[model samples]
Target: MNQKPVNLFNTFQLGNLHLPHRVIMAPMTRSRTAQPGDIPTDLMAKYYAQRASAGLIITEATQISQQGKGYSFTPGIHTPKHIDGWRKVTKAVHQAGGRIFLQLWHVGRMSHESFHANGQPVAPSAIQPDARVWIADGNSAGQMLDCPTPRELAINEIKAIINDFRQGAANAIAAGFDGVEIHGANGYLIDQFLRRTSNKRTDIYGGDIPNRVRFLEEVVETVVAEVGKERTGIRLAPYITQRGMNDPEAIDAILYAARKLDRMGIAYIHLVEADWDDAPVIPESFRRDLRDSFSGAIIVAGNYTAAKGEAIIDADLADLVAYGRWFLANPDLPYRLQHDLELNEMKERATLFGGDAEGYTDYPDCQEKAS
Candidate 1:
C-alpha cells in the first residue's frame, strides 16, 4: 500500500523552529531602506508584517558592514542604529506570528567605487565582475552603475570580515531575529571566493577546491559559533553563470562545502536556482547529490509555482519552497496557494526598487480585496 502524500501546507520542523507550512518568502533586495545610514524603517516593518503568514521569511540581503554594501538603500546590520531599526521589524513580525531570518551579505566585486571611501571594493582577488549595482543619485533616484576593478583583500582583512559575520549574527539575535542566513550565492563576496573565475589568489584561501571553500567555511564556523548551528542557514547558487560567475567547478565546490556544513549540523541549505525564462534546468542528479551530502533541511527557490513546489517536496528533493516575486505581490500568498485564489500582479515595475508603499505595502490580500 502507498503512504500518504506530503502536502506543501503541512507543518515542518526546521531546526529549532516549528513552521506552520512549507511556503517560504525568498529574499529579494527592494533597496527601500532609510537613506544616509542604511537603516530599516517603519515602512519596511509594515511591509514585512503584512506578509506574516509565510512559513518563513528570509529578509532582503542585509549588509553585515558598511564595506559589505553594494546597492543603494539596502539595510545594514552593523551599527547600533541598524540593530534598533531591525528590532522594530522583528517585533512587528513576531506580533503578526511570523518567523524571519536576516540574510547577511557582502557584495565584494559586485560593487561600485561610490560605496567605498577609498574608491575600491574588496574581494578575494582583483578580478572585476561584469555586473552593475544600483547607486542612488543626489535626488534619491537610482541608476545601475558598472562595477570597477576591486582591490584584493589582505590576509588580515579576510579575518576581519569573518569576524564581521560573527558580529552580524550576534546583532541579529539582539534585534530579535529568529535566525540568520549567510548570503553565499549570486556572485557576492562569498561566492567570489568560492569560484575560480573570480578568485586567483595563491594563499590558503585560494587554489584547489578545499582552499577555495576555506573562506566560506571560516565564515560559517564563526557565525555558527556566535548563534549555534541550529539557527544558521546558508544560500548558495551553483547553476548561476551570470555577473561573471561562470565557474565550472562551482558544483563540486558547493557539494564539498555542503558536506562540511552537514558535519557542522547547520539548519538548512537554501539553493538559488536559475530563474530566467530560458535558464538551464537544475538536473535531478545534482538534487539527489545535494540531499545526500546535506542531511538537514533544504530550501529551493527560483520562480516555483505551487504545483512545482509540491512536486519537489513530494519527490523528497527539497523540504521547503521559497517564492520571491509571487510573495512580493501577494501578502497572503500561503492562503491563496492553499485555496487556489488569484494572485495580484505587480502594479508598477519601477516601484519594485527604492520606492515607497506604492508597490511595497500597498498590495492587498484576498480578504482586503473582497471587503
Candidate 2:
C-alpha cells in the first residue's frame, strides 16, 4: 500500500483566505433554527466554529427570499436580522481561524405555499413536482407534506430574483463571509431550470441547454459583480442520481458551465458526485473534462474518505475533497486525517433533522474537552 504524504498539511488558497489542509467541510442542511424565521443562534455559531479545522467551510444552503424556503428551520439571507445572525457566525468562525462561504439558495417549486411568506410558491414554470417538503407548526413539531403548484415567474420577476441573489451576496459580505457560493445544485430552483425535466418553458430562462442555463449564468454574473469573481463559487449537481434529478449526457452541460465559469474567473466549482446511496464515483472522462475546463479549484463531495480524498487530489481530478457525514460527526476531522485516527460513526438519521442541539452539537470530537 502506498503511504499518504504528510505534506497534506501544506497550505492552499481559497479566494482571499489561506487554508491549512485540502479537506473541505461540505455545506449540509441541519435544519436547526429558531421559529417564525430561520435565524442563526449563538449555539449555531459554536457548532460551525467547532468544526473549523476544515480547510474551508461552506455554510448550509441559505434561502435568499421567503419563496426560496423549502424546509423548516433552514437559514436565510434575505433580512437584516439574518445578516446580523450570520455576522455573529462568521465572526466566530474567523476567530477560530476558519474561512467560510455562504451558499445562496432558492428552492423554487421545491417549496410549498405554506413555506413561502406570502403562501405562494414560485418557480420557473407554474409546475408542481411530485415532491414533499417539511413544514413547521408552532403546536406540532414538523411534518413532511406535499408541495403545491408554483406561480410562474414572469421575465420581470426573473430579473428581480437575480437582483435578490446580488443582494444576498452583499449581505454575505456584510456578515463577514470570506466569499459567497451560488447553490445551483440538487433539485432546487437553479437546478430546476437547468434540467429539461423540470424546466419546460419557451422563454429565455428555459428551452435548450443555454436557455435553460440562463438563470444560472445571470446569477453567477450578478453574484460575481456583487462579490469579486475570485470570491464567488458555484455548487452544481449536474449528475445527481438521487431524487430522480438528471439530464441526458449531464457531463456535457457541466463541462460547458465549468468552462463558462472559468472564463469569468470564479473561485471554484463544487460537484456533488453521489449516488442514491451517497457513494461517489467520478467517471474518468468527466474528471478530466472538469480538470481541463476549470482553471480554478474543483471540490468533489459525497461519501469521500481521507484516503479516497487523497487519491482524488493525487489523480489531479480535484483540488479539494469535501467530507459530509464524516465531518459532521468529527469536529476535529483535519486533525484525525493528519494523525490517521478513526472517525466516529455518523449520528442516527432519525434525529438528524429539526433539532435544537441534541444531534446538532452533541457529536463528540476526537478527544473530550471541558466546555
Best by lDDT: 1
Q: After the best TM-score superposition of candidate 2, give how far the Cα of residue 132 lies from its true spot, in angstroms.
A: 2.1
List, in order, the clash count of every candidate structure.
0, 0
TM-score of each: 0.98, 0.94
Candidate 1 local lDDT, 1-371, one digit each (tens):
13222478899999899999999999999988887899999999999999899999999999999899999999999999999999999999999999999999999888889889999999999988989998888877789899999999999999999999999999999999999999999999999999999999999999999999999999999999999999999999999999999989999999999999999999999999999899979999999999999999999999998888989999999999999999999999999888877789987668888878888999999989999
lDDT by residue (337-371, candidate 2, tens digit) is: 88887777877775567777777787887677334
**CA RMSD, predictions in order:** 2.3, 2.1
For candidate 1, report its TM-score: 0.98
Q: How high is the lDDT of residue 20 in model 1?
A: 97
Show model 1 residue runs off by greater than 4 Å. 1-6
lDDT of 2: 0.83
When summed lDDT is taken over every stretch of 10 residues in candidate 2, the lowest stretch is 1-10
Which candidate leads in TM-score? Answer: 1
